[model samples]
Target: MVVTVPRVSGQVRDALAAAALAVCAAVAAAVWPEVRPLDAPGLLLLAGVHAPLAVLRRWPGRALASLVVLALPYHLLQYQHHALVPAEVIALFGYAVLGRRVRVVLSVVALLLLTCVVGMAMRAGGGSVREQIAVIEGVVAIAIAVQVWRSHRARVAAITERAERAERTREQEARRRVAEERLRIARDLHDLLAHSITLIGVQAGAAAHLVRGDRPVDRGELGEALASIAATCRDARTELRGTLQVLRGADGGPPEVLPGIAGIAGLAEAARAAGLTVVLDDEGAGTPPPEVGVAAYRIVQEALTNVVKHAAATTVEVGLARDGDRLAVRVADDGRGPAGGSPRGFGLLGMIERARSVGGTLDAGPRAGGGFTVTALLPVADVGSVTPR
Candidate 1:
């Protein structure tokens, strides 16, 4: 088993570091031959230099300033200068890494100049040139390293932000696709059930009327009505099964062939069976892309369904014509429009969505002459040429 170490807080870590540095400085002052003995004043000065380190990260500039102020007094009082050098180095590192660049540069330059002047004054004979050069070189090297580290940290932060943004975008795109698929499935279900059930209901109602009449029941007509119901149910079951298989992504069989514009005749025939006179006028509209074909077929189907359910008139005219790259489909009924002002159902919305999905447009409204009409304009050219709405 692997062992996990508990994390240490920054404040606790800083306090421990400051305590260790103070102890080491005290030990060095007591043992080192070059250092003077620690007096009460000298011990106080040492504490002042190292104690600020505990809060260095929280207040880098202030801690650095405190170290400089105490260090000057320690040096001027002739205390062991080497004992507190480590603390001064730690303070300088905190300021270089955490303080603003402009402020750090100014503070470091002022401190270095002050140190050089003080050293020169302390040595009446003047200090060695090599020692001054070494000190300046060390400070410059530290500054360069700090700047490189800061640059690397900034780059890492930027890269992480971009990755997070990309992940969010991908998630949003996935949700949009899922929503569209759900809507497509809902439309399919509505069209299949609405058309088949309405026809079956009409056939069943006719058979009931025959049986309930005072005269003897017409067995021949009743048999035909029952057969029609059976046929409609079988077709609905097959289509539903195919839809489910497609949704399951089963590779056991070939994909189901969706009905296209050519299948509009079947829609008209079915409507006629339900007692509405349907007129289909096909003006040699050439074959369209699969998406456009499917969209056209569904739009016509939904328009017919709306008429059967809401329109009271007996006849509906479905016209198809081709003009250049456009395919026009119109479904007109000599019936009253929606009982109310306009249609308030998913059928109309589904038809509109289907047309728009294939970069087409559909309009439904009451005709001035009297009746409801749905007109759709579909592009017969390559689907890629049209921008989806």
Candidate 2:
């Protein structure tokens, strides 16, 4: 069986050391021939010097002062001197390692003065002045070495903290970018599927109505409805393929051409196929920046999708005009505004996010006259280039 010995705490070890030093000083005072015999006052002074070692780390300034105070009398009264030097060294080392600069300087000066007084006393008792000078040098060396070690440890700790802070900042930025990319992809998928599926549903319904009617089915009308469904499916497939390419991180071909302001006519045509009269008015001057154009196209697309899906009205007017440095887009439909009062849905939220992402604003609400209107003001000039996501 292995016997495990518990580790001693720093305070406990320091106490043991202090007690051992006290015992040693007492023994030396009693038996050493060159020093005076141990007495009550001398024993008290020895205790004062060694006892502070037990708490040297916790209170370095106090410990060093205690040692210096008691050691003076011990040396002046000519008690045994050698045993107390170890305690003095420990005290000085503790203060240098932990004490503030002003206190350390003051303590060092006090200790040097005490050392000079001791050397003078020893000289009168026939001790060599050279030995005292060497003792003073040793004390100075210990204080300087401890201070250098402390400074080096402090510098290392500061550098480690800075590196850790930089790592955390990088991680936070990466997470933010990932979140933005996910939101952009979701908006794209929603707009693509919603428009295509809504159109296909409307066309399929028309074809079914013609077949189930009591009158003989109109073959031309039936064919037109089927053709619209087929065309919508084809467009949806192309857009899905492009989106998939982006998801797979492929750079094999020229990028998919995104629909922009020019694509509004196509949207209007699709809505017209769904049995709505669409009036498109384009009053814009020159072409907008690609980012602005894409935003405009998506907002119009989403607005029309909402109209076809929910509006019972038969007419929608889409207007695009340049107002100074901004492009104004407005979509209005004679629809049963929004069901149950407020205009709230994921489609509207996505449109708002897209507008704000390019430093623009969108307002959507029911017109007081009887329909819903979505109006967006997009910057047309000097809108900084954006990477397609």
Candidate 3:
């Protein structure tokens, strides 16, 4: 998608070339007849050599080839070389620009042999050897000059291609870093809000029900629940600010304390407050890396959040285990399954992304027992031991 117009310098060069070709054609037409006998074949050869110059830029190889094919017979049949004969040298240069060097070299050698043979024939029929030698020298000098020109152009083109590739590689890296940063910020936001919001909703509902009922509220329990809700809100707000500050690049690094594998208990408590009976069992080996920990915590948190919103289940089970080089997590709920259920939305999508980011795999679907199950196998401290998916 980018269109570039010709530079003024290039346009000027093309104009000058067109003008020069026109002058050559005019001079050849008017002068060649005066020098040699006026002939129809000579005029046609003149036209063929000059006319192809117009299309040299568009198809330099083809135009040069045509000129060479036309020139052999034109020079051979003609009784003597005319002023217009040097036009073939210009075609040779054009061929060097767009064609192969070996081919050009071969062509020059062939032309050399042909000219000497013609000179021999001319000598046998009354011609001069010295003039033929002069022609050979001119042809050799021109071929050498054209080869040098082609070498320079080839070098310049190679340098230009290398620079373009470097620029493209830099651009792709910048885009990739930007995308990864955005994903980190998003995962932070989801972890902070999903669990806290669910807990706050449950606490608020309980407080409302207690006040609305005929029973006198236990002021201490009511106060404690409200305090918990306030504390959760405060933490959520601070976490959000940290996440945003990181996104803006004002923060030094990730929030010093990201919720990790250890924080799954809070997710369970939040589910309990939301009226889901949650049983959590964590059995793992060596500690996971920070990135893997964050991913694991977020995956569990999101799974529980989905249960609170859609499952309406009475019992939920959460498990974490480390086997060999992998960390495995499973969340199963005994509720109405995904069939005839509301779309799970971006929550599951985010969990899947989290899993993959840490070189993990996720599988979430309805269980055969009329519930839903979300299972993930993630690379943890032993990430280097496993090949990337």
Candidate 4:
């Protein structure tokens, strides 16, 4: 259905003008013979009220007061019947449309009361009890109009506030639903992909051992492939668990630390099993806090995994050094070159994100002689201690 737009201010102006015009015509008709014939001054005063009534909303009290004073002499000279007129009605409407403060209304009403008293005392010809009653009735009409206008304004304001509150509530609910969906996806990735990749490393290591010296596959190549699988699994687990914890709720336990400097030996062992010559060197052996240590371990692990996946290096080297408050890990491969010698995608991005998440930094690129190198620095103290250096 179509709806028409309303112009409230324009409508108010038109209404007030129409009312004033009617009153002017009435006064002219009732008092024309008694005064002078219908002419310029009479018609002009009658039309003047209508023009100002359009601006009554902008200046209600002023308009109302001006009209009352103007009406006085017109009534006195024309027809002093102590009767209600069109101008009086328009003045009343002006008071209602003005939206002035209650204090202002009270003050204006007090003036009207004084005017009523004086008008009664002066009492124009043949103006008596009946005339006084008519004047009182006009004042009553003005007061009622003011009250009705105030009530309409208050109702409109209340509705606007309610609508705004409802909109905010809906937006919050949408965010909550989106968060829940993310957690569900995280749980699926953890259970299905992370666990599957881990098993691939175990199987690959075994396959390399079984094929030792007789097959087309080099035992060392198989071992490096397995090592890469294991590292990928660990990284996936860390990312997946972090996501799922949000679904479980904010009250979940501290983050699961994937292994740190201490886990370097395990990494070396896995790489060896896969047949790649691997070495691990630690400059500082102090145990670090779960977060920093985990970040450090993951950095080295991912770098080593990348070396196995992309580097043609037969030997991988990992070095860890702690300087003052910081711990740094460096992983390098002395291989033919990166498998395709082209760096791409999530491997490097994940390493950078892991380092940044724990307030650390990472650098990865090609080495001078050949192969690829990755260097990472983690703030051990900043992330808190897992164990003392």
Candidate 5:
């Protein structure tokens, strides 16, 4: 199959470059004395000087070799005909760009120096010594210019390559962080909806049953169930709204009042509303930093939610205390836990990840006597925040 190249930036650059070479060649040939006819040998020699430029960018070394052989004979045979022979000088520039080969460049410079010498000797009868010296000076100036231009081009190419690599690295890092944020949001929503809705479902189902029972219904019991349902829904709504705002990114205003060690009492109240009595004890020094506070709040919240869902217990004790540099939190329910001392679900996994994010640790298992317990130790440092989705 034949391949076609699309006109990308690099291809466009090459086209502009080829056009520039064509212009240079035409200018070089245009200034010669009375132009030779298309059929004359002089015109053929002119083609040898100008035609190789068409491929100079693609094959600079070969073009330099060819231009040297062609321009040498033309200079020696017709030194007095044109004021300047540009082909050999232009070839030096092409070789400068396409190579780091010092030997090849030096050889070409020596060849051009030889041409200037031979041309001056041949024209000694007509041109003065000063004029001959001036010609050699111009050739030396051109050689120095080619060397300087080549060094600058090499430096620019190296710097450009380094810049491109850095840009690519930044893009890759941004993509990776985005993927991690999306995953965190997915997990937070899962925990919030799964645990909150389960409690709401239980309370709502109980309220529905009592109102429609065969026997005379107790107004107080039905009232408590309905109240619990309402409270759960309110908590879910508030938490979901705050989480969405966090996901949208922070606006420079007062931070949302998130759950922390102080919020454990509120969480206990919520659990108590769901028909379980929860007791809370606080022994920490000052308020924990927002990160430690938030992780502590989530740990307690998740544990109590588990108690309501699976514990089938009557009372839960929530405790918070500062142990040296760590804020330790514990939630123990006097109800039967899973026989294996572990819950096979993302709930425990989310709790563990939360603790780890804040440079903390968590342990949960069945108590020796009866119920289950979740204990966590959170560091009060700038490890990271466990921000909700």
Candidate 6:
């Protein structure tokens, strides 16, 4: 098993520093006696080489080479029983493991072991041959362990990085799918609820007109109004049920048919039936794109809905014109309001955002003469090309 420095909290780095210094001092003590009977000062100077080895990872190749170079002076002095085996062995392991320099590590190991063997033979020291062999074996084991540990660490780091990147990618894709689902649901609600309400408004007006001159009330007309209302309610309930299923994590249903300019006349007819007089003046020469047609439909829908809710006006005007390359749509209501005053609510804001989504501009404010006006300008065609509905 390989021994690594644990990433512990509080006093760990300081503790490691002290432990390494102590270990180096102990090694120096054992090797000091071997180089006695020679200049004590020179041997002390040579032992100081181990100081740089403590910071080996900070400068691996330089420290390893420096340790070997410092050992040469003791050999030249012919110091008694001087052994460079321990320092050279540790330096080789450091180079191999942390520095990952296999060639340099092997070369250093062979050179140092050969020097120790030759020196032992030349000196005729009293130390047992078994003890020297044991030291060589220990160093070889350490070098092998360090090599294995380094390889494992590199593989682990690579796997962790790839996993994290994949996780992020998956999260982004999930969010995008969720957002598209919400937009689909919104479009569905607009189609079903809006269509059903406009139908109810039409039937209600017809029933009210048929019984208007009756002495009390026509039971037949009342029954027809109630029947129409029930059908509208049933249709809304069916559409809302499907929307609720999607919200509860079910796969969404089919797309709903959105209204375009063809439906705008129906919208005007609905308003006229609901006791509001609507006059449409369409002056555009060219056919409008589908997106622009949809925008025009929605603008009129919102304007009429607001008139039903807030405006007590009897007459409204919707105008459409092609001004050069742009399609201009305007809805003006003769409702009670000061000219140039702001209207409350997100109704206008919603209209503006819808226009902007299709690369268009929208403005809504009180007209100078009487009531409120909403005007929008959209591109006649996107890049001179039209998208089919």
Q: What C-alpha lDDT do the candidate models reach, one value each? A: 0.79, 0.81, 0.71, 0.63, 0.73, 0.65
TM-scores of the candidates in the order shown: 0.78, 0.83, 0.74, 0.54, 0.65, 0.57
lDDT of 1 by residue, 1-389 (tens): 99999999999899899989998998877676232477888888888889999999998888877877887777555555568767877777677678776345645655664675456456523343344334445654555565566668778989999999999999998998899889889988998888788888887887888889999988997898788788878877877787787788878878677778888888888788678999999767678887888888888888898888888879999998886788898999999889774788899999988888878888989998889999999887777776554
Clashing pairs in 3: none
Query: How far off is residue 164 in model 5, in Å?
Result: 4.7
Superposed model 2: Cα runs more than 4 Å off: 1-10, 22-43, 57-65, 71-85, 92-133, 385-389
Candidate 6 has an lDDT of: 0.65
Clash number for candidate 5: 0
How high a TM-score does candidate 1 get? 0.78
Q: On residues 277-321, what C-alpha lDDT tens digit does candidate 5 reach at each position? A: 888888653688887888888888889888888888999999999
Q: Over all chains combined, what TM-score does candidate 4 have?
A: 0.54
Regions of model 4 farther than 4 Å from truth: 1-21, 24-44, 51-258, 283-285, 336-342, 384-389
By summed lDDT, the worst window of 10 consecutive residues in model 1 runs over 124-133
Question: For residues 180-265, could you state the per-residue lDDT of candidate 4 as single tens digits?
Answer: 56544543453335333544555565665657756577767666665666665765667567655745665657865345578778
**45-76: candidate 6 lDDT, tens digit per residue:** 44555555666767777777776666555543
Worst 10 residues of 5 by lDDT: 31-40
- Model 5, position 136: C-alpha lDDT score: 53
**Alpha-carbon lDDT of model 2:** 0.81
Clashing pairs in 2: none
Candidate 6 clash figure, as a count: 0
Best by lDDT: 2
Per-residue accuracy of model 3 over 49-72 as CA lDDT, tens digit each: 566666666677777667666656
